[model samples]
Each structure stands twice: as structure tokens, then as C-alpha cells.
Target chain A: MERPEAPEGAVWAEHVAPDGYTHRVLARGTVFRLANPEGGACAHVLLHHVDQPWERLNVADTVKVQWNAYGGHLLLSDQGRVLASVESESGYDALCGTTPKGRDMFVRAAAKHGLGKRDLPPSLSFFQGARVRPDGSLHFTGPAGDVVTLRAELPLVVLIANTAHPLDPDGACTRLEVTAWRDQPTGPDDPLWTATPEGRRAFENTHEYLSARGSA
Target chain B: MTVVAANAGWSALIGAGQTLTIVDLEGNQAVDFLVYSAADTAERYSAQDTITAQGNIFLTTGSVLMSNERNPLMTVVEDTCGRHDTIGGACSKESNTLRYGHHTRPQHACVENFLAEGAKWGLGKRDLVSNVNWYMNVPVEQDGTLGIVDGISSPGLKVVLRAEVDVIVLVSNCPQVNNPCNGFNPTPVRLEVA
Candidate 1:
């Protein structure tokens, strides 16, 4: 995996080879972006608030609460708070699987932090996406140079493992690059929070939780 | 046969083609249930696959629980309660504290039960996933908001499942005292193998 140059003045950047993983404690308002330069490289990502690991990513509630799984949607915690919002995406995927799976890799990454299997929850995958039919049929859409950007709505620990996603068909993932930059966090005044009734409620839950602690 | 005490846990290596009957001996008790392939625990119940396959979230009689690999692990053979919840996952102290407040942090939760009971089989936290909440009622509105409310089941109501393969079954009789899912009162249930 060739290393890509980090963007100028970027907070952080890293090249994740196939079978490699990374974890970072990012502050609220971090603009995190992941790219599949060569394609077929799926990132099985997990997230938890830096201060509160219990409020981790819940893919079930994320899909159920949003009623749709796609880019620009809010990914929620089981407690109904918006952990991060998929701000933009090209190769969109909602599933993870196959060899060196995100699940096992996640366990290892979590264990590094003294967090075990119990700390992990269902997560989202990027790079290889699926477009489903009404009858429950679906196919993959893995495009090269695909990218996704996520805006953290809270201080969080973002973990990424370059693992195979079932839709990729490669049975193994490839090299990927990630970079995080500073940005303004999503707040109640932000339209991202008021986009939908569901989004609004989730943001409200997030807002109340944050406000109670005097966090702006 | 096992009479799981109130707020206790139970498990079994259910053989393929055999059925395990879960009787809600006391009404409104939410049972948090999880299952894994006895041959390869990596293949465990995937709520995503199950809901995707069924085109619905609520599980009931005839619902085939699917694994993360998209294979059927079990089938609901009988469901007198009619609808079971795959959306309202097992509760935990972390979540209990998040929702109810810090005072409830010491209270036992379904996650603890799974960890303690699952340890007997060499399983740990990594093995737990979004679990089935038997007899728990979580209504989803058109806006996708979920409300964990009182159950529709009554005392002695039963839900039975036949193993589609050799599988390890783990259960936590939900001890949540913060929500109405268990009517804020925990109780015991009965499990019978046939």
C-alpha cells in the first residue's frame, strides 16, 4: 500500500494497508474522510463517544431510525443520539463481511483499548455499496476512487479496519487512506439536525445530553 | 427443562430439528435472547439479515432467524404472543445509566446476564449482538421513532423456536427496572426442550 500525502494543515492522516486498522480519539466537529483509491477496499468502521464508550454506534437503530441507509444520513446510538452523520459519499455500502472480517478486527482494535467484544456494536461499511430491490434483492456498486466524509456530532473514538465487505466480491479488502480535519460541530441550529422529524429527535437527544453537561 | 429464576440467565446447545419452548410464565417479562452456530460461533444471529430477509423488524411464528452469513439458524415454530421484538435489543447498565440516569448504573442488565451466562460456554462480549426481546413491545411510528412500551403478552403465553442447525442459545431474563418493556417489574420464565 503506497502512502498518500496528508492534506496540508490536516489534523491527521494515515494509510491503512489491507488487513490493517486504525483508531483515533477525535474531538467534536472533526471532519473525517476515508478514500478507496484503488477500490474494492472496504472500511468496516466503528465509533464511540470519546468520553462515553457506551454510546457507541448502533447500525440497527441507525437504519431503523432513518428508515434508509445511505450517505448524508445520521447514524445513531441505541440511546437515540446522533453519533455521526454521513455527510457525503460516493461508493455507498451498508454491509460488512468475509475474510479478516470487521467483527474480528474490531475485537482486536477494541482489545487494544482494553475494550473487549462487549464494547463493539454493529457498524457500517464503506466502499462497496448495495442498491436493494423491493423484493429484497440487491447487488453491489463498488467504484474506484470512492470516498465518504463523516461529521462527528460529538467527541468520539473512530475505528476503521480495512476488511472485506460481502458486496466487494474480492473476498479481501485493499489499501485505504483516511484524513481528519477540524470543523464546526453540528448543533441544534444546524440544518443537519433539523432535516427530518427523526433526525430532529435524534439531534434533540444528543443536544440535551450535551447541554446537561454544559457542552456547547 | 429449566425454570429460569427472575432476572437470571439460561442457555443450551439445541440440536438441529429440536425445538425450545420459551414460556413467559409471568406476563410482561422481556427475555433477551441470542444464538450462535455451535460449530462456529462467528456465525451468530444478525438482526440486519433477519430483518432484511423478512422485510420486517418484528419477529413471530414463521420468522426464520438469519445469521450474519445470511443462513437460517432457527425458525419460530410457535408464537402465541404473535409479535416479538428484534428492534429493542438487550439492555445494559451503560444504556440504563444513559437513559434512566447514573443512579441506575449499579442495576443489573441483560448485557451483564449474557456475559456471565455466556462465559460458561467460553463466549464473551464480542459474541453479543442485537438480541431478540421476547414479549417486549416496541412500537415504531411512521417517523421511525421507537417506543418501548408495555407488552401484549399475558401469563403463560409461549414462543417456540426450532433450531435450523446445531446452535448455542443464550438468554437473559431482562432485569431492566427503568423501562415499561418489563412493566418495570422483572419476573421469571420457563424453558422446555422438545
Candidate 2:
């Protein structure tokens, strides 16, 4: 398959083959983008503080805290810090993908970083979503092209798997293109700095930790 | 009815359609719960699927506990604690030290309970998932901040769950001493199945 062109200013980019996974450490303020070219692909993403493995992505906290599952929302760490935020999104699917395939992909990625199966936590999916009907039953939306960018708020260990969403009626997935580029550090002047009181506190936590380490 | 001592753990195989009731013998105690297929431990409780299917974070009566495969492991047939938490994950030495200080590292926590009991069933750390905190109060503040405040449950308060399948139930009578989730002090609970 022909690889797509790298996005402008990308520090690095790669097209992960279908059913494959990738892991990398991205710096704070890096703009990490995941693009599903075929539109049917779903991606399972896991993140942790690049330096602190104990502080990892907490999907339940992300959904429970925001009360929404949109693609471009605050991705929170278990320790109450904003690891990343959806800077922009084209397709909405923040479903938690628990399929063995999705988890195994991350398991492989985690192992490369010296993390074991037990270290892997629940992950959030992209490019597929579901809605609750009036009857309390779920109605899954069809696959859609996912072009989402997440702004890292903390230096992060980004792990991603391009795998089929377990609930996808079609059960089809393809390659995913990931690109990382440098961006200006977030400051009080940025709208996202204090978007919401909850986000503000998360940012404060992130910033405080960074400053304590002399990274901020 | 089986009495679970404070800071201890228990596991059992509840038959399909059987009801298991957990009573907070002492008010304000947090009971961490998990359910897995008796025939296949791989199909363990999934907080994501359960919360996604129900469109609600707090579980109460009439809630169906969904598995990773999207099947019902159990249902909240009866609940008197009003609401239960599914997001505040089981505590561990790592989390204890992260939330509290490193000095609290030696304290026993829910993950240790799950690991000890789950190991008896051939389950390992990978088998555990986010668990239900019954009688524990975790309120999502208006600003979306989660607070582990004192419990809303009182003495004798219980929640009943009916196994939708022959299921293995694992529980940790939460021993957390660092938070208000257990009132900073753990206590005993009662369990009965019929």
C-alpha cells in the first residue's frame, strides 16, 4: 500500500499496517493526529505519563468526568491530570474497545515498554460510536472517516492499535496514519487553558506536576 | 449468609438466576465487586460496556452488568444504597501510593484482594477490570470532578444482584484507609445467595 504524505511540520509520521500497532513517546504540546483513510478503520489508543507509568489513561474517568464520549474531549489520567485533549475531530467514536484483538495489540505494545498484560488498562476507541435509544437499547452508528488530533498536555507514552471495533456490525478495519508535530505550549491565553472548571483543574494538575519536575 | 471480615476477600460461584445480596453490616463501608463467567473467566465484568449500554454511570436497581463480550453477567435486581460507583477503580499499592504518600505502600488494598481470590480460580491480574463500589459515594461534581466522599449507605443497607449466568463473584470489603470512600476505616459485610 502506498503511504500517505506526512502532514506539514510533522516531527515524525508512520502508516501502521492493518492489524498492526505502534508505540512512541511524544513530548508535551505535541499535536498527535490519527487519520483513518479508508473510513472503516477503528483505533484503540492508550496513554500514560512518559515518565510515570503508574499514571495512565483512565477511560472511565474520561467518560465519567465529562459525561460524554465525543472524540475531541479531555483524555484524563487516573491521577486527575489531563494527559491529552481532543484538539479537533472529524469523526466521533470514543467507544471503549475491549475486543481481544484490540487488547492484544496494546498488550504487545505495552510489553515493548516493559509493561506486562496486567499493566495494560482499559482503552478508548476512535472512528466508531454508539447512541442510546429511547428504549435504553444501544444503536451503533456505521463506520465513518476518523481524522482526529489530540494535543498532548503531558509528555506521554502513546500506544495505538488499528483494530476493528468489536461492536462494528461490519467488523472491518484497515491501516491508520499517525503523525506528530510540535505545537506551542498551552498558556492562560489559550481558550482550552480554562475551557471548563473541570478541564482547568486537570490542566492545573498537569502544569503543577510539570513545574515540580521543572518541565513546565 | 456468609460473613466477610473487614479487609478480607471472598469468592463464590452463584448459579444462574440465583440472587446474591451484600449487606453493609457497618454503615459507610465500600464493597468492591466483580463478576465473571463461571465457565469462562475471560468474560469478566466490563465497566465500559455496562456504562455504555445503560447510558448511566451510577448503577442501581434494574441495571444490567455487561461483560466484555457485551453479555449480561448479572443484574441489579434490588438495591437500597440508591447508586453504586463503576468508575472509581479498585485500589492497589500503586494507586494507594499515588493518591496518598509512599508511606502508605504497605497497606492492603482491593487489587490485592482480587489478585488473591482470583488466583484461586486461575485468574490473574489481567482478568481484573474496573469494579463496582457498592455503598461507596463517588459524586461527579458539577465541574466534573470526582469526589470520594462519605458513603450514602447506612447499617443493614444491601444491594441484591441476580446472576444472569452461572457466574464467579469476587469481592473486596474495601480496606482503604486513605480516603473517605471507606470513611477512612474499613468494616465487615454480609453476603447471602439463594
Candidate 3:
């Protein structure tokens, strides 16, 4: 089901790069940040609109796409629209190979960013284990939980499928929640998020109109 | 707007609110860099973590840089020119020999510069990982391949990273003459850490 055929007039919403593969966008305005392994510029698709309409979709805005052998609707966004989607691909074991696994660092940073321990979805399964390092490459936990080791060099994105314990009933796969920058809290304690440049401009105009109304 | 130059061998520390600007006074210079936790030098920049967090193969402005332990290292505050390289890992001795002719194995590269400087502050080889090529450009081919192309960066072009915390910065004005990344003319660079 690679390149699941989209219906007519369907906007190219987002680009998905499967495990062991790299997906590049020919359009601009499509911004992509690495999911787990997290440090690189916001990779923009070569199109004029980087953010697709799919990014704004919520639970009801489900557009069926081929998921791990099946399609399911999961709670996608929040009131603030920070989180755009909650994806779970079954039957395929994949990993955010670049991200760290520990909760301590994640907790600390999340707290600083207003994402407390409670913020993480309670339904999310957690894992705490060290990966086996093979001769020169990294060792991975396969979809069947078998230790598959390889000797690869640095700067590599590695994903092992068919883990014994899939995050869901289907095989393991990377679940990414598409997000927006402006909707996210600036800091843990900060109640208000920073608005984008356009948002800020609109806010100012609205505030001015309200002020004038109050005076009149 | 700010300029700092690096002599043959030098290091600098960049603090918060201030940005470190690297300039290639002469064209074709590759700047090798390493970042560490200012509060604790034990933990260093982790390439895997960074790549995962950012969700891309390259680094440039607007990227919220992450550390190995999954901490925010810095953010690309501003960039006059766009498109930096994150997939093209820093150059090393073995790579120098392999990429170039075997006889060019002895060339000093960004990797060595990072290790040597980090050692001065109690860092080591394990600390080195993926880095951002500020002005370097590598375009993917039609077949989904990568090639080091002539840089799209020009003189006066700069990339800025705002420190999320007090960060220790190390950079080596690249001396690689083998590829077009450095314009076949590795030159000195300016370092401004204010």
C-alpha cells in the first residue's frame, strides 16, 4: 500500500517516510521535524503551503489512510490544536531510532515546556531498556523482540519491525503527533503560548477594535 | 552582523542572549563544531537525539536543537541564508582518506578539531556526533541520492543559534580541500561568542 492512492482533488496533506526509508518533499511550506531523533532544521517541503490542511484536522476530521494493514480513527488534536494527529500503524515494528529512551530527561524538559508527567497520554505504552550494541553497529529489538544486530556507522536512521510487544495489536510502527509551534506553551508555567507573526498581527487589530468599542 | 575570526587553533565559549557567528574570511572553509551542557560537561550533543527531535536530515534556522540526553541544546535563532546540512557528518581522518585519495589521509578535519578542543575541557571522542554545516549544501538527486554541491552560501551570510542554556562551543575552521563544500579553498573563519 505504498503511496496509498488519494481521491480526486485531495490535497497532498503530509509526506510519510517509513522506517529504513527517506521521504523528501518536492513542494515548499511543508515543515517536517524528526519525530524521535530530534535536532535539525524544520525541513520544508518545496511547496508554497508548508502546513497541509491535515495538520489542522481533529478527531472528527479523520481522513482514512492505509494504516498497519487497516485504518482506524484515533483522537488527533486538542483544543489548542497543538497536536494535529495521533497515528498508530499496526503490524509493522518501527522505532524513533534517533530519540533517547529515558523518561528523566524527557520529564525535566517537558516540565520546563509545560508538559508535565500528566501531559503524556496515559494510554501511551512505556519502555525502559538498554539496546544491545553489536560489533560496530547498533543492536535493535526486532518486531518479535529478537535481538537483531548490525554494524553500521554514525548518522544513520535505524528501525526494527516485528517486535514481540507491539505498541498496538498490529506490528510496531512510529506514531507521530503532527504539531504546531504557535499553539505550544512557551514554557511550563506560561499559560499563554506565543503567537506566530501573523497571529500576533491579527490579535493586535482585534484588541484595538475592542478598545474602541469600549470607549464608545 | 557580528563577526569573529578563528586563527590556526582557537576555541570560544558562547553564552545566552549572545550568538556565535562563524565567517569564512576566505571561501571554501568548513567549520567543525561541538556543543556541550554548560551546567554539566559530562553530557554532550547527541546526533541521534537531535535528528529524531527535529525530524529531518538537515539543520538550519528555526530548528530547536536537542542534546544526546534529549535536551534542548539551542535553537536556530536566525539565518540570513537558508538550507544547512545535517546529513553530511563531520569529516574525520578515515573519511579524509576514503573520500579523497588514500594519500590525503593525514589531513586535519572537523572531527579532530572537535576532539582536540573538547579534550582541553575534559571531553573525548564519544562526545562527537552529527553537526550542522552552516553554509554547506548537498542536494538529493533524482534517484534519492546525495552529493556535496557547490555551497549556496556566500560572503556575509550567517547562521545563528540561540543558546537554550549556557553552552560550550568548539569549532574548527575546516581545512578540507577535497570537496566543493569548502570551494576547494579552505580558509580561516571568524568566531564571535558574545
Candidate 4:
């Protein structure tokens, strides 16, 4: 008998967070040990908010959480269904402040990550423009330079764009991790994505950002 | 090693074996993408299929990514580094307010760049789903957890992908500096495909 190969295409590596930094999963737990030196010191810690299944949030409920400019994590799970997004901030505090105001920032960021700017209330202000690639990597630079590469899974894989540095020796990259469940479990179209205002906002953001851009 | 160019006002086609590259000429950027079937739009990129086929969270070289209609969109033909985040999702206004503060809610995000460039293409919300963060490192713990870590890529690193079929690409250079994913300092990147 052979042990099953871990989920295919799973990634594993260290990560940063708010409370402190942990090289752990982008979801639960914290901290992961790096196998080499270039991996950097595992010191940056960020905060995360895991949605409670028992909580039944409806559109009437105040949008409980959002992730605006700061960098943080958001996971949407309903048994097998799930949707997750990460927010990037300009200032550290703006990313994961604990104060009600801090959490609000995450909520806003989450909103922007999940829903589109138009979905925001008049009272809610917003800025836009982040890029994502078909390979699942986001592009924040421009049309002809280095690109940051991001992926979701155990030991997640992040690649540098253009030059094949330590990350890409041949200037091309392709690896597989087996940690993620093969079954999609759930998707953005699922009702679970927008049961509450917050969820609706997230779904809205997802819809807006994930669409294709046309020639201007 | 190979380069592909998309004129500001135009688009190009990338066939299988022909990998398309998007570069962040500067730094600290994000790219938005839409994967459509060379045959039909109805069979577009399905984040669900991509995840299910890969059986993992993040994507990288060697990962044969699938589309919504169960078609292979693009294969991770080559990757410099080895970490990517599939669950971290993207940036937006609502997320800005929720993650930062209501005061910072108006800050620019990825969705804006996507729509600003995508609106004319006839793409809409119905086309959104699971996306891959190329340089981003969102790790999972032994107990099944996740978090964003520093990027595995440095300046000039590239992730190469071969289109299984003709696929359209959209990108937004990320402008976020608050997180370590960009070392708290969002920088520019370069894109080249041939």
C-alpha cells in the first residue's frame, strides 16, 4: 500500500501577520519553519478573522468585516464551500488594528477585496486599481516590469516577475502542492458568498476585480 | 527568458507552448486577469475548476490550471520561486475600509484597476472567481491555517505560464504597501511574452 500523495499543487512556506509573524497557513494556526536561508527570518505576524458558521449575518446586519488597504486574510467557508481574500495596506496599523476602528479597517479592506468600489455606501470612501493574472498571480506594477506572484495553499508559492532570480532560475516557474482539497467544496456563485451585507460586499468586490479588462 | 508585448491600446493571443508574461515595470503592483475559451466565452476560467483540478490552494509552474467549463486554461510551465497564494484574493474599496479604517476606505485597490481596464471588454462580475497571487506567499500551517508572508520573489523574477489554448490576460500592478507581501514597500515589476 502507498500513502496518498498530499493534495496536488499545495504550497508551504513562512508568512507575516499582525499580532506577530508566523510562517503558517494563510488561514488558521501560525508560523512555519523555512528550509533554507534566503527564506528570511520568520518574524512578521499579521491578524486574521475566521468567520463563524453559527453566525447568521443577513444584509440587515451591519457589514461585520472588511479589508481595505491593509494586508490581511479572509476565509469564507460553508462545509465544503469557501471563498478567501487577502487585503494589502499602506501602513502597518491600517492593516490589522485591534481597536474597533482597526477591525473596521479590515472590514473595509475586506469589502473592497470582495465587493467593488461602486458597492460601497456613499459614506464609504474607496480607491481602486490592483491587478491579477490568469495564473492566479496579481500584478501591481505596470505593463513591462517585474511582477509579484502569489498563490494559495500550504507552503504557498510566491514568484518574482521578469528576471529569474533565486525564485526562478530558468525565468519560468511551475510547482505542485497537494495540500488543497481537490473538491472545489464551494465557489463565488454559491449563496454562502453573500448571506450578509459583509458577504454580499465581499462577493461584490470579487465580481468587480475578477472580471477581464477591455482595451481603453 | 521569453517576452510577449501587449500595446497599451491593443491585445495579443497566446497559444499553448507560447507562454504569456506580464511584467510590473515598476514595483508594488497587482494584475487583473480574465481567462476565456479560445472557442467560446461561455467556457471561461472557473476558479472552482482551477482549484479542483490542481487540488491545491495556490498555483505555480507545473500546475495544470483548469477553467470553469473544465477546460485547461493555462499550465504553470515555469516558475522561478515556489510560493503562491490562491486564497488571499484581491484588493478593493470595501476591503480597504474593513481592513484599514473607514477613513482609509477610499484608498485605491485592484478592483478599480481591473474595471478601469476591463469595462470596455464586456467583462462583468459574472466572470469573477479564484485567482492566483504570483509573488505573494500565503502559507498554510500543519493545522490547516493560512497567512500572507513576504514574497519569495525579488526584483525582476518572473512566473511563466503556457496557455493551453488562446487566453486573454489582464493585469493590475499592485499598489499596496501595508503588507509584507511587498515588504511593506510596493514596487514595480516587468512583463514580457513571445
- Show pairs that collide, candidate 1: A92-A129, A93-A129, A117-B125, A117-B126, A118-B125
lDDT leaderboard ranking:
2, 1, 3, 4
Worst 10 residues of 4 chain B by lDDT: B1-10
* lDDT at residue B82 of model 1 (Cα atoms): 81
lDDT of 2 by residue, A42-136 (tens): 77888988787767887755664554544436888766688888854543444445466777788789888888655666787777765534332
The local lDDT score (0 to 100) that residue B15 gets in candidate 2 is: 99
Residues B1-194 of candidate 2 have per-residue lDDT tens digits of 89999999999999999999999998899999999999887777888778766766678999999987679999999998898887677777645544554566689988899989999888875577678889977665432345577788899998999999999999999999878887777989999999
Off by over 4 Å in 2: A90-95, B1-20, B24-45, B49-129, B133-189, B192-194
When 2 and 3 are scored with TM-score, the better candidate is: 2
Task: Please tell me which model should have the higher lDDT, number 1 or number 3.
Answer: 1
The candidate with the higher TM-score, 1 or 4, is 1
lDDT pick, better of 1 and 4: 1
**Weakest 10 consecutive residues, lDDT, candidate 1 chain A?**
A91-100
lDDT agreement of model 2 with the native = 0.78
All models, DockQ values? 0.15, 0.16, 0.03, 0.03
Residue range A42-87, candidate 1, lDDT tens digits: 7878888878686688765565455444443786776668788885
What is the DockQ of the complex in model 4? Answer: 0.03
lDDT of 4 at B18: 81
Off by over 4 Å in 4: A1-216, B1-13, B23-32
Better of 2 and 4 by TM-score: 2
Every candidate's lDDT:
0.76, 0.78, 0.41, 0.39
| lDDT of residue A38 for candidate 4 | 25
**Model 3 chain A lDDT-worst window of ten:** A40-49
